[model samples]
Target chain A: MDLLLEIAQQVINGLVIGGIYTLMALGMTMIFGILDQTNFAHGELYMLGAYAAFFFSMVLGIPYLVSVCLAILVGVLLGLMYEWLIFRPVRGKDPLNAVIASLGASIFIWNAALLVFGGAPREIPTPFLGEKVNLLGVSLNVQRLLALAVTIGIILALYWWIGKSRLGRAMRATAQNREVAALMGIKIGRVAELVFATGGALAALGGALVGPIFLLQPSMGLLAVGKAFIVVIVGGMGSVLGAIYTGFGLGVLESLTVGFLSSAYRDVISFAILILVLWVRPQGLFGRTGERGG
Target chain B: MKTLPYRNLWKWVGTGLLLLIVPVLVRDPYYLHLINMSGLSILLAASLNLITGFLGELNLGHAAFYGVGAYASALLTMRLHLPFLLTLPVASLLAAFSGALIAYPCLRLKGPYFAIATFGYGEIVRLILHNWDTLTNGPLGLRGIPGPAGFINSKVEYYYFILTIVALSLLAIWRLLHSQLGRTFWAVRQDSVVLAEMIGINSTRVKVLAFMVAAYFAGVAGSLYAHYLRFISPDTFSFLESSTALAMVIVGGLGTFWGPVLGAILFTWLPELLRSVSEYRMIFYGLLLWGSITFLPQGISGFLESRIRKNCTTGVARDAHS
Candidate 1:
């Protein structure tokens, strides 16, 4: 009974964490879809988002909700700056150039954070801190449930925006064929910037939501980005829905591995699965066949 | 004309003598240490250039093979108490085998897919190093690794040891580039489909061979690193180390001979130069990386080559007009 209960708890925890992974992967996939460049610094943006939230709540004495909002806004602004300053000049160059540039940006941001905030982990006090609810004889943290609800709501909102809005249509059009979209009177450049900002915002939201659960630290971006890349690869680089599914699946798998197996091998199992997925379907689970490049 | 080969031999002898005379003239152990490190890094950067620059494969997890080589050599020497010289070849072979293993599954991937897959492979190696306590001793890391005996106990001796390895590896790589197999690698890089149709060459075979050769030299460097540092840990072979190696190749001018060497020297000493601005060293490093990619995408060596080519063309045009 105890084993079953532990397994159940692990699954719930994994699902909640998977929600954040889904958001991170979605951001990366969206950027890949539009720009065809893998933003190596996406993880750093996520880290910055967490820091933004931490600063707002801890330093500025804002409410948790206000902090989350501020984090998203800050993420969007930084994303815009990235597009304007670094990516704009190297727009048509080889994808490798962009990859290297993003790596530079990642190092720059991470080190800046380290210098400014120091290497110590910062805590974000949850709105529902110290509260636990029992479900099916298993004690579940209320903060985790809140994270799940927020993630689901955001995913639904994103789906509706992408499916029904004119801006979303333009973004999709640009992603599918930039030249054709431009010919059809779409401002492809503006759309790209918007997509990048949106992606950054989503990543920031993920970071802020998970800040309470995991301490906010500059180096925290490395692990999050590593796992997020796996999700992006497994879900296919350009598929939004694919990222969500694979993110959740990977989360559950990792949780189960940690629960049943050793915690040390958590990353090992995740990467093994990524390799297997790539071996079987190199295009990723939701990647369109023959969409070459990044 | 008859004495041309002899003249070339004499020139080579002069260069070798100059290299030997350099350390004695400097007489600074610190500079000698830097030279030794540069030689090892040259081997690493040059080997990495084979894949990233020549073959046009972006492998982000290169240090994993390096780590593999280090651990393999470290275990052989530490556990079996074998002679250090024998362990170098064993480590290189093991690393090559593992590189082949990784390449088999990952070669099918193209572009960023291959890059991401290799990244995963690197993480897996690090995780194993962290978790496999029975073999790696976990985070405690292996210590008391023996240094080279006799002359190598001194910094100048160690410089010779590394310089010899660097010279041998550079020669082997140069020869490989000039061989029929080297031509095939270039052909594959230009266009795999064209090479496949015209020459009936299996691009996969060429790629795997290039990857393995690169891994072999990296293993050699890794073994040297383990013995030089006299310590082995997972922290030493992080993604940051791999990225820096890749940066050296890119900033040196990919696919150009001597570019990586120049890049290795500049980048290796860059941090040392910025030692005064220690607080913002990494930030400056990041900005420099960005500036290099954004502005001088072809790298310093490439920029200089283009300038020389332009000047020569202009001079020839002027002469013709006159």
Candidate 2:
């Protein structure tokens, strides 16, 4: 009975963190799918999101919810900047060039952030921290609950926007074949801008949402980006649904590991799962195999 | 032809004499230490160049092999009381085996996927090094790692030792590049799987061999580093270090023989030069990386090569007119 309660509690905790992973992975996969470029600097946007929210709320004394929106706005702007500055230059070049460029951008931003924000970790105080709500024999922290709720809402909205919207159709077309989409009059640049904006927004929101849960640090993005990459890979690169499923699934698995085993081994589990997935099914769980040209 | 051979002999002798005299002229222990580190960095950058530059595969887990070599050498010397010479080979072999281990599974992946896989492998290695308390001392790092005894004790001696190893390794790499195997590496990098197979070459075996060679040199560098620094730590071999190695290769010039050597020396010295503002060094490094890739795609060596070629052509044209 006790073990069941513990497992249930772990699962709940996992889902909340999983929600944040989903948000980051969504942006990453979208960039991969549409732009056909990996954004190694994606984590910096997430870090900036947390920092933006912290600045707006803690430093400037703004409401938490409003700060989150502002943070998202910053994310969108940063995303557009990424499209122009980082991804644009390497477009149509060797995919590795983009990787190197983005890596440079990532290193640049993270270190610059360290100089600007200082190396010390900071936290955003929230009203949700002290409150807890009981749900089905388990008590959940309100902040965590809020994060989970917002995650679901965003996921649903993203699903709708990508599925039914005209712009989303353009994005889908662009992802399918950039040359054909351009031939059909879909502006590749516009689609790229939108993809980067959405990716930035999603990653920033993830940062803003999880700011209260985790300590915000300049180097926080390094680990988050690694995990996001794991999520992206396991979910099958460029697959939105894959990112979502793997995000939550990895979160749960990680939470269980932390609960049952040691926190030290939590990341080991994710990476192990990544290697295993690559070994057994290189295409990922949902990704189609041998679909890409070398 | 006889004159050409004599000229080449003179060049070799001149360069060798210059290298030997450098320790005598600059007697500063600090500068000597920097020179030694430059040699190790050259080894690392050159080894990484083999995979990223020659093989056209980005192995982000490269520093893991370096770390593996370091820890293996440190432990072997400290615990098993094995000689430095023996530990060096054994550790490098272990790293080569690890390279093969990582390369086998990652055979199917290419480009970003391969990079991501290697990144994961690196993190796993780092995590294990950090967590495995009994073996690695769990982040506290191994201290007082015995230096190669008997023949070498002073910094100058260490410099000469590293100089010899680096020159030999570079010679081996140069020889390999001129061989048929080297041409195959270029072919593999061009289209890799399809083109190599079309030409009756086994791409898989070639890739594995390339990875082994790269890892072996990286391992050698790591061994030298462990003994020279007389310490070993997991943090020393992180993703950051791997990127730094990658930067050395890229800033030097990808797929060029002399590029990494120039890059390694420049980078090794650049950090020390920027020690006053050490905090901002990484920022500068980042900007340099971005700027170089964007503006100077050919890197310093490539740029220099082009200029030299242009000058030679003009000179030849002028001579013809005369």
Model 1 bad stretches (over 4 Å): A291-294, B1-14, B190-192, B195-197, B314-322
10 residues in a row with least lDDT, candidate 1 chain A:
A285-294
Clashing pairs in 1: none
Per-residue lDDT over B1-322 for candidate 2, one digit per residue giving the tens place of the 0 to 100 score: 1011344688989998999999889989999999999999999999999999889887788899899889988999999999999999999999999999999999888789899999999999999999999999999999999998898899998999999999999988877776788778877774666877898999889899999999999999999999999988899999999989988888988878788899999999998889999998888877777777877776788778778878785532110011
TM-score of each: 0.95, 0.96
lDDT string for model 1 (B1-322, tens) is 2112354698989989999887888798887778888887898899888888878778889899889989999999899988789999999989998789888899888777788898899999988898899999988888988876655787877888888989989888877876777767767764464755477888889889999999999999899999998998999888887888877887887777678888888778888898888878778767777888899987777877778878785532110011
lDDT of the candidates, in the order given: 0.84, 0.88
TM-score for candidate 2, residues paired by index: 0.96
In model 2 chain A, the worst 10-residue window by lDDT is A285-294
Per-model tally of clashing residue pairs: 0, 0
